[model samples]
Target: MTELLERCPVCGKTDLREKLQVQDRSVSQETFTIVQCQACEFQFTNPRPDAASIGRYYESAAYVSHNSGAQGLINQVYKVARFFTVRRKVSLITKLNGGKQGRLLDYGCGTGHFLAGAKKAGWQVTGLEPNDLARADATTRVGQPIEEPSALGTLAPGSFDIITLWHVLEHVHTLNETLDQLIRALKPGGKLLIAVPNVESLDAQHYRQDWAAYDVPRHLYHFSPASMRQLLSRHGLAVRQKLPLALDAYYVSMLSEKHRSPERAGGPLTVLRAGYSSNRYAAQHDGQYSSVLYVAERGA
Candidate 1:
């Protein structure tokens, strides 16, 4: 058994309450418990595999980010979604910076898919990816060497104009330390955009504990808007805006349906209906999508 988290990584409060026992549905059939901290209301997986031991949890041919050979109906769907998301991200960065040129860094840049698009958009792109297999593929796609996660705090301070983590923040083991590194790496008035699965979204409620986003043993932390705000505030960062990723609601819902039960996983039609319902809820409210993009800026 792995060591349990004694305190909230955000508040440093030792009061933790176990919420749910979620299984690693994809790779390890092992179960992990989710806990909520009393002081900060932050949720995270308890007794999780530490950084060294956790790598094995991600070792599966089906892990798409690391293995390009990961093929299936879900992987195919994710690839199609990636095509649209990469373009959307590029457009977002252009609008945010009011220019196509800037220094951009992408953390956990899986296969460097988004980096490739950012580079084409005239940004000097640097990518950090942990998986060796994925780094090789990313190099081919990004036309640059992707650095390892260990190189986070080693980067030049105040160098990057923009830093992004798309659906990657949840997997980070040293959450606060990693966040500090990213903040220090940003230049004054620089923007840091982080996208993570929102456990407060309607789809997560619909799927209950079966939501694929929980992804225990893999996803270390689950963020609510409140928790995220508290985290950024501690580092003197301010959340400029919250952007909902509409397309992610669909993808996450579809995957949630599959994760519910392999034998009883819904069909395409069922998944479509679930996705639509989730997106509909998000359209009516801001920062309520299944996955959310948090736009935070450093103090100028």
Candidate 2:
């Protein structure tokens, strides 16, 4: 069953305007509507499947993160990208800590890739994943027992030095609740790293409603850079830095073209051209790429 949200989850406002309708290309192929809050300008999917029913939506072999099922050419590319991205994430966290290691908690750590990388970098690592299949895979990969999503609240307060959510926060059903738990688990002055698709990016603008990153009900929320910052600030967190993920423009654009037209999606040459164009535009335009990594810190 699906639940239609009446109020803005972020602001508790009732005034929302319908922005666009997008179909889930990855799985069910059912169309969902995107709505924007008149008060906060935050956007989200309405009439979305509740947490219970939503798991069925992600039960696809193509959802690579949950399992090691790298089937298609796209999945193959995703694995390669994930490899480098995990290393980069560890490096970024190391840099944030002035080349030192600390306790790190990765929220929604898919398949234990980032957790494994962080562990190798000398940080005491822990992971929380909701998907049972992914959690089991991650456990084997990390060689440690990964906690379930239900374990978040049970964690000791102010126990972690850093918490990260890479392309995970948007999929969370409990926005404020999850953030609050994360904040409590983080020590004062610790960092929260979140990466999400930016609706205001050049590639997003070009793709419009067909942007693949707008993964509809699965994404739940559409966060522009400003909206992200605002959300963080509201929870007593401060944005310390913003880093653009250069690689996502290409991948998102490719998926977008595929979403736009199956024929366009099938043509290698067409996908390459569209991705190249989007990447070039993003690289030149003030660093507003496809997705952004926001480095936030809790105030002491």
Candidate 3:
């Protein structure tokens, strides 16, 4: 067995603790360890898999496009529903800032679906995608060129009015540097929206090591609301809103369970029941299940 070796990327802490150990799609066996910086409350993955190993998992066909097919009917409906929901949210935010006339950039835009949607809604849209196939798909789908993060240097500083990282923050190798680039690209008062799995949610606690969101080596950072706020504050961005968006917890639970025991295939009824309970819990409580949508703004 190969021993995992890594250091805390956030607080420069070498002292780490094992949080959870589980199996994942990328590795035969994996451990999700959370290393805490005593100096700062910052916690991140230690002994994380190298970039090559993690990249193999993402490059697979299973991850090429959004896995809409893996979801059930209700989940599918929600996926479609979110299109309108996201549009409305963006529209409201843009309206609040005057109108949607400024440039919008979507980081990690897989196949450029959201960017296409944003363009249709009247925002000038651009995208950054690392995967070649995904980037090609985005170019075809959005009918515009999608650039890698490295190419971002060509654009003038402080040019964008809105920037989005929809579930892309966790995969970044250099979280601070990536965020710095994003922040530098945004004009003063520009909005930056980020959506990621909430480590402090009920689903996280229930699944623990088997949590799908941890995603082992793929997800380098597991963010709580407080941690995310601190990260933004460090970069001169003020967190304006933290909305708990309804996510398909049942599906996530299914994946987590499957990752834990690949041999045990969960039945449809069991998955449905879990999903219902998760939805009910989220509805009753304050968005405590799956994911969170963060809205922040650059300070003058």
Candidate 4:
């Protein structure tokens, strides 16, 4: 089943324009159209696979978050990148909480790598994974049972000191509802970390429709910092900081290069150059990295 959105989720605007049609490179090769709202500059996959049929699109082993055991050069590279990124994430969480240990909910935890790191760093971690395989893997890694998306409604109000959605919000169908639940679960003034791809980033502009971050049907929405702020502000959340996922530039560049036709795929040097250029551009401009990690706080 496919669902077509008539209004923009961010600003509730009906004035939407088709931006581009991108193919699902990871799973189905079917093309999907990306539409942008003139009011908020928010882009989303129109006529996207609805919640029921969406799982089929993520059924491949190439979906890194769900398949920790995935084998290949890219997967291997991802593992190494994840090692450093996870540590950074943990450190950032601690720093954000003012070096206090607290209850943390990792929504869309994805094999629980970050949860394990946080647990070792003295945090009470709870993981929620939608995928069965990934949930099982996360359970084993965290040495605790992982809950499903339905658990969001079951969480007590003001229960968690922190809630994180790392590249997970884009995939959610009930965007506003999910945010409401998450906010309700968070303690007053609790931190909410949301990491997502930035469509306005240099790499995204460079690759355009061929950008791997698009990931088509999988990434239902393409967000910019401005668009994200509008969305969060609607729920009474304020962005405290905008940090860059530094290594994403290189990873995204590599995947973007591979997405191009054989002649345009370019070599490893070209990929590295694109990544470096993206980072440099972000440094000069606002910190709009290929992927942005937004540290937001709920109203007290």
- Please report the candidate that would top TM-score against the real structure: 4
**Candidate 2 per-residue C-alpha lDDT over 62-110 given as tens digits, one digit per residue, 9 for 90 to 100:** 8888979768888888889988988999999998877899999999998
Model 3 poorest 10 in a row by lDDT: 61-70
Q: How many backbone clashes does candidate 4 have?
A: 0
lDDT for 190 in candidate 4 is 97
Summarize candidate 1's per-residue lDDT along 1-300 as a digit string, tens digits. 376778898899899998888878888888889999999888999988888889889888888878767899889888888888899899898788866579999999989889999999899999999989999999999887889988888899999989999989999988888999999999999999999888888888898778889988889999988888899998899999998888777788777777776787788788788878887887786657888899999999
Error of 1 at 10 (Å): 1.4
Top candidate by lDDT:
4
Give the TM-score of each candidate: 0.96, 0.95, 0.83, 0.99
lDDT of 1: 0.87
lDDT of 2 at 35: 95
Model 4 clashing residue pairs (backbone): none
Error of 2 at 127 (Å): 0.4
lDDT of each: 0.87, 0.88, 0.72, 0.93
Off by over 4 Å in 2: 262-266, 283-286
User: Model 4, residue 143: displacement in angstroms?
Assistant: 0.6
Q: Local error of candidate 2 at 141, Å?
A: 0.6
lDDT of 4 by residue, 127-172 (tens): 9999999999999999999999999999899999889999999999
